[model samples]
Target: MTLAELTAAQRHRVIAGTFTDRVRATKSWDAAAPVAGWTARDVVRHLVEWFPGFLAGGAGIELPRGPGVDEDPVAAWQTHADAVQAVLDDPATPGRTFANPHIGELPLDQAVDRFYTTDVFMHTWDLARATGQDDRLDADYAELLVTGMEPMEELMRSSGQYGPRVPVPAGADAQTRLLGFIGRDPSWCPS
Candidate 1:
């Protein structure tokens, strides 16, 4: 299978896994941090909104430009995520040319899974921090990122690409380091 296909499947698994893990851990909860900062709910909310924004950027499809954003966070998430998933499921649907913040002219298929799946993997880190679910991510996800980044060394050099420069624990394994590389603090918590 192509890299896009492989990454797409991996992304689905990660997204599914995240939902499952969160549902298992907390049936319902309030914000992760205080009103001033992001809550666990906010993270999911962002994931939901991100679908359309990046997809639009990637697929070159445009939605009816609405107001800045919906005031009700919950409704906003449900609407965008549902639409985003539907469009992505249709293979015939072509993603547009996107000038991405990280991966530059990311192709439609690559952009499709990259944005979604990477969110899957990264948000797992977010959820872990939000709820204090402190078990490291699975190795397969880390491998995808490791191998994924190696080929794109030039892109990885960009600040927006590959993730942030958070330091990994010296003795930590690949997964931890990968998470750290991608703007997540494995030891992150609400301050």
Candidate 2:
């Protein structure tokens, strides 16, 4: 699939996962997620806080920040997701050019796919783990990400976007290996 198509699919997964995690978070918003100190609410909060800047930078459109998760987690996520979806839905977005610190200037859609979409997908796992939901990521998507990111590992790590790679079992599943590549231990659980 093209990167745009992949991004769209990934976004759908993110939306579904976010909504699912939102429901789950009502029970334990303060529980620690797999990403160390971040809680279930913080997982959504991080996305709500960061996605608009990414959309604005890629689409060259002003997007005001919305309520934070502390104010209202569900509302915060819904608002942010809707704004991002609108940008992704726009016909002009694909053709627009945008500059990214990591990849420099590229088509807006490509930048969104590379940076934002992948983040949402990966963080879906964090939200799920935090909320005690099914956190087994799609193996195919995980494999694709692992392959695509291996070459850029140094750059990504250098930028502090990822932590030191964790060791995975030799026969670990693709999702396990992928999580390990991005510095998350697949077996992690909240204490």
Candidate 3:
């Protein structure tokens, strides 16, 4: 099945698994990442730090806290990812409602899938790039996200969640276009 066709649980398993892989492969937590002023650890830090509060506020779900990113990024990510996966895996969670002021209400799983998991998918490239690992993302999924976000460009830009879009070459590949859409330079490498 296409990544977009996967159930929320299945999608998280795939997207989060890639982030987990990048986490495991990370050799320098302090390495400079593609995001301006964010370290490799900050990539994990952003994911682990942001989602729990969003989940709690929206769905009343509290994910377990683990090692601090400063202390151990790998353990921090593993704990956070495992907690998120467990929530998705819970039989009781699929039907839960998530209510947010900005986005209104959605099924808890869909909320996580739409906001949190996609963030993880994009940040996977940051972590991988920082660590000098393979940074390729699923092309189909990248195209899907860019197409979905293009219409929301103004709102997203105003939210400050993304930076200004970077320009890519004519007819750039899906992944490259995605990187640019998300305000990352597809050609970025650590200095």
Q: Best candidate per lDDT, number?
A: 3
User: How big is the positional error of residue 26 in model 3, measured in Å on the Cα after superposition?
Assistant: 1.0
The number of clashing residue pairs in each candidate reads 5, 0, 0
Report the C-alpha lDDT of model 3 over 1-191, residue by residue, as the tens digit: 98999988899999999989999988888999999999999999999999999999998888999999999988999999999999998887778999999999998888999999999999999999999998999999999999999999999999889999999999999999999999999999998
The TM-score-based order of candidates, best leading, equals 3, 2, 1
Q: Please give the TM-score that candidate 2 achieves against the real structure.
A: 0.87
For each candidate, C-alpha RMSD in Å?
4.9, 2.6, 0.8
- What's model 1's lDDT at 49? 60
Off by over 4 Å in 1: 1-10, 20-36, 62-80, 94-107, 150-164
Question: Which pairs of residues collide in candidate 1?
Answer: 32-39, 32-40, 59-95, 59-96, 60-96
Structural similarity to truth (TM-score) of each candidate: 0.65, 0.87, 0.98
**Candidate 2, residue 146: CA error in Å?**
0.6
Q: Show where candidate 3 strays beyond 4 Å.
A: none
lDDT of each: 0.58, 0.74, 0.93
**Superposed Cα deviation of residue 75, candidate 2 (Å):** 1.0
